[model samples]
Target: MTSTGAPPDWTTVDIAVPRRSDRLPGISMAGFRQRVPSPVDITMVAHPAVTLLIDLGEGDGIVYDTPGRHERGSVVIGLMPGELRAGGRVGDCLQIRLEPDVAAAALGASPELSGTIASFSDVWGRDAARVEDRLRAAASWDERFTIAADILGRRLDARSPVDPEVAHVWRQTLTSRGRARVDSLAGEVGWSRKRLWSRFGSQLGTSPKRAARLVRFDHAAHLLAAGHAAARVAAESGYVDQSHLHREVKAFTGLTPSAVAVAPWLAIDDIAWPASSPTRNPGTDSPRHRARELGAGGCHERQTAVRDHC
Candidate 1:
């Protein structure tokens, strides 16, 4: 797939969108290489404003570190820090879902919940040690996720309920409009601008407008991956112009639209299609649709320069 060579002895199969569950709407699955015996370094990156993570797979654990060093294997159950970044090796890891509440909780005021999930060695308490032990003892990816979910569920349940109206407004603004006017969203949520900011800051670690932008970026990435043009995707995703789209794509993904389109790794052929959903197919574009497509040209040349230099 994608000319990566018969799949590495251990390959990661990631599914960006997952079927809805009673608790979470979306899921991301990461299938680790079974043959790799030692931890293989990997990175987990997210769009700005989204901070929660779910560990559905295997290996020692995930480590959240700063510029130079990092903590080793640790299972992070609650909200991740605002600047939390993941780096570690994955082995037999399955799936993880970042729930809204977990994300919100991490954004709330708490010393233990500030930034990324690090190893037990990085933290200072007995609780962290216990968690480390449990994670290491876990046998499978499912077991790890189960423990993580339980810990997060407890932490979330202890927090005060968020205003349903505000949450509703946010959901609507994100899913339908792809952007939110802070003043307008505040009005719909029956809160003052200050109050709305406080709520969003404490719950999302970012403002509503910022969160909306991240959501919009996610949608845009999907469209680009589906072979849509930059101009069309920009309009559909609520950007002002193709240049704006390009800027945002570069900032979030470190790649331009055309580069992402032509990258062998981003090709549809590189992924394993889930079989349960008959409605979903990776490369089922009609001949007519393919005919109207513009191949990645200029952007490809620029990306080639970056790759060659690296």
Candidate 2:
């Protein structure tokens, strides 16, 4: 399913999603096409999953920057990549989000890579270019998703997966919206606190506490973007108070709740990532039906569109 354009002023991008059968557990994919050729720049909000941004456009398709670092084209962004921005003339780009456990199995990288960005080539070697070439040659979004899913499935199956116990803990953390306690989780998984902590950190590249905070912050950010009041969001999201929410939001994106509320990045979630809500299951409507309900079947005044460049 896909949505074309929101409010012209809000966004100028078109979004496409895969069929339900194309989705993999703990993985979400979105395709973005820019409607205009003007250069684009966007602040990439931190997300709870490891993200793969595959550039399908020619010539400096996408450029990402963090303090003291710059990378062009396809890149893998880790959880909490502090203060990052993506810019450049993008034509077609595919974004893939992977749960950390799935990422660990697919990427086979160490924990140290989780809080930073890595070039696609650095992770996949020569296969990165080959895969991009195939994706670029595909005729439709569905084809690209199929190829991408096949690749991920192969890699995931080839590797020795993270411990089942660790995977369970991560799922618990997510299902609880980051409210699950580490000690309790460890007990449920039949591991001691220290073992669970060490194993989880080593396998997932983040501690249980940090994962919870990121998951919690992500939920709150979405609520804020969805137009909820900060005070109410703080209360609903399990914060100590409004002040705690402020501090955490600041720590995550270096922005206040108010600023984050209207952020273009978060604004696209309803269309680009409709299945990501922590409190809800994926919608039951057909993709086309859902798109219509979202008023995304066509443009209307004040509607938000994904820009032609991302």
Candidate 3:
């Protein structure tokens, strides 16, 4: 993977995606094995999901800067995580993208994780090493996937789920690809605006408006990466104009729309999140198709004055 300026050459990367039956709701899994690797430094950009990377690497394979630095065997990347990267050497990693609702249960707490990056041990404690050991010891990538799925699935069942109303609002925001308005969602969900805001932030970790913007920006960023014009992306992704889109992009991630479109971090998204959407698959050609998958996670709705139409 190319970092420190030059874009990565995609041909050398080998990414393994799980079969449909192996998939878990609200989670995306991919086993990444990079060939012809080099020291890599690139922006992680901002996305709507909580990220968990289990280093299948022999040593510390990644380093995260800015947003509370920490390094270890595996890392937990909170929602809207800013720039970060894998180090100069290539290694194996089981990258899992957990939707906010699912993450609240699986990772222990959403408020504890939002906009932060830390070692998996910071949250999972010893379980981090135990799971990593099983993954590493497994004979095949598929077996590793199974191990991870079991752990996460167990956690999902173990912890209390988010409130039904809050979960509904989140699902609506995602289904609308961040275009859903807060007021509209609240009204639909029959909750007072203030109550909805309080519960959403407390349970999901980010305010409702912020979550939608992150999801919207994520959708737009992927579209831009797919070679769609910024103007076109803005119009279709629900922005008032290209400049509105530009501001949000720069706000969430320190990069302009053009740069984010070709971000090295997103270069491997297809292999990493193949089932992020229904039609998308690893190494696919359509950016538009992949963009759709970016917000494929679930949530419901309610209405409020705080809108994320930017």
Q: Candidate 3 — which residues are off by over 4 angstroms?
A: 1-11, 274-310
In model 1, pairs of residues that clash are 10-33, 56-95, 57-93, 57-94, 58-93, 81-114, 81-115
- How high is each candidate's TM-score? 0.62, 0.88, 0.85
Measured with C-alpha atoms, the lDDT of residue 84 in candidate 2 is: 82
Q: Provide the lDDT at 10 for model 1.
A: 28
Off by over 4 Å in 1: 1-34, 37-44, 48-69, 75-88, 106-145, 262-281, 284-310
lDDT of 2 by residue, 189-296 (tens): 899999999999999999999999999988888787666889999999999999999999988877789877656555456666865643322432322112332233
Candidate 3 Cα lDDT to native: 0.70
* Whole-model Cα lDDT of every candidate shown, in order: 0.46, 0.77, 0.70
Candidate 2: segments with Cα more than 4 A from true spot? 1-11, 278-310
Residues 1-310, candidate 1: write the lDDT tens digits.
1111122232323232222221233223222322334343332333322233333346555555555545544433233232334445544333333434334442233224333443333332356556545644766444554564555456566766455755665576555545768788788878898998777656645556666766677566656756678898899888999999999767655667876544333332223222211122246333211212122321110010101110
Worst 10 residues of 3 by lDDT: 300-309
